[model samples]
Target: MSETVVSVRDVNIYQGSNLVLQDVNFNINRGEFVYLVGKTGTGKSSLLKTLYGELPLREGTANVAGFDLKGMNWKKVPFLRRNLGVVFQDFQLLTDRNVHQNLRFVLKATGWTDEKLIEEKINDVLDKVGLKSKGFKMPFEMSGGEQQRVDIARALLNSPKLILADEPTGNLDPETSDEIMQLLFQICKDYGTAIVMATHDFIVINRYPSRMLKTERNRVLDSAVPA
Candidate 1:
């Protein structure tokens, strides 16, 4: 049976007091790679925030990584996030820490206590992102691409079932963006992790086509199921 990693139905997304998206409906399955594309201020970020519990899901029946979005409290948001990985446009790595320390800090905050296990998991994710040898390097020591890799490694720390990637390739060059795209698709195929990536790079989207969800005129239009 195919598993639904994210299901949003009749969702009304808000930013502050404005209704950004209305009556949104979509279903993302395990191992699926879906692209979220739209112009700025079209509710792409708002929708992504809703999925990862950054924005409140009001007037909707939505479930993400098995967590119901309705009535989600601040205390419960972290638990919901534990099962979902979020990638930002700007790689939000701690500048004060090296790659390994950055990853370890996330693990520790997420309740990981065993030192040996943390080390092992760190290596595994680093290896997955092709940065196994750069764990000791500081964030400033790496290139934008390398730093982005570290960000991806951090996202994998929890072995999350779903990843909400917000413009993951927004800051990279063509070559580096291609590399990140390959890595992301590989993760989805290899680990059965569903990915919902928000991007405005049409070159990358056209280069690597997948199911697309476009945010236009206060609604989400799915290319897979044409309206």
Candidate 2:
């Protein structure tokens, strides 16, 4: 049986009073790698925001990582986020901290308190992202790919069931992009972590095709559906 990590149905996404997307319905299952592709300004960000609890799902029924999105408030957003991980295009690692400290910060913020467990968790994520030895290195001291890996490591700190990645390969070179893609696929396959990545890189898409959700003309199109 496939486990569903993200379920959106009859959802209306908005930015303030402006409606961005309507009647959006989709479900991402465990270990599935899905692509979110659409031109800019087509509510891609809004949909992603709604999933991660950054935007409120005001007029629909949706659930993410077992949390109901309808009527979700600010106080409940953090709890929703802990079950999810988000990856950004730009490596959003903290400038002031080393790789270890950055991951440690997220764990602490998310309510991890045991010092021994914290150290083990940090090591586990770093090892998963292939940054075990670079924990002492500052973000500035690493290459773009390495920094992005640290960003990924940070995302894995909570062992999230779903990861929402926004243009994760946008800033990398072709080779680096390939490496990131491979790593992402490996993680999904190995850990049953569902990934919904938003990207405009068609070349990457052609090289590694998967189910896609396209945003166009105020609606989301699912590739899995027959025309």
User: Candidate 2, TM-score vs. the true structure?
Assistant: 0.98
Clashing residue pairs, backbone N/CA/C < 3 A, model 2: none
Candidate 2's clash total is: 0
What's the residue-level lDDT of 98 in candidate 1? Answer: 96
RMSD of 2: 0.8
* Residue 196 shift from truth in candidate 2, angstroms: 0.6
Candidate 2 lDDT tens digits, 91-161:
88889989899999999999999999999999999999888898999999999999989888888889999
lDDT of each: 0.93, 0.92
TM-score of every model versus the real structure = 0.98, 0.98
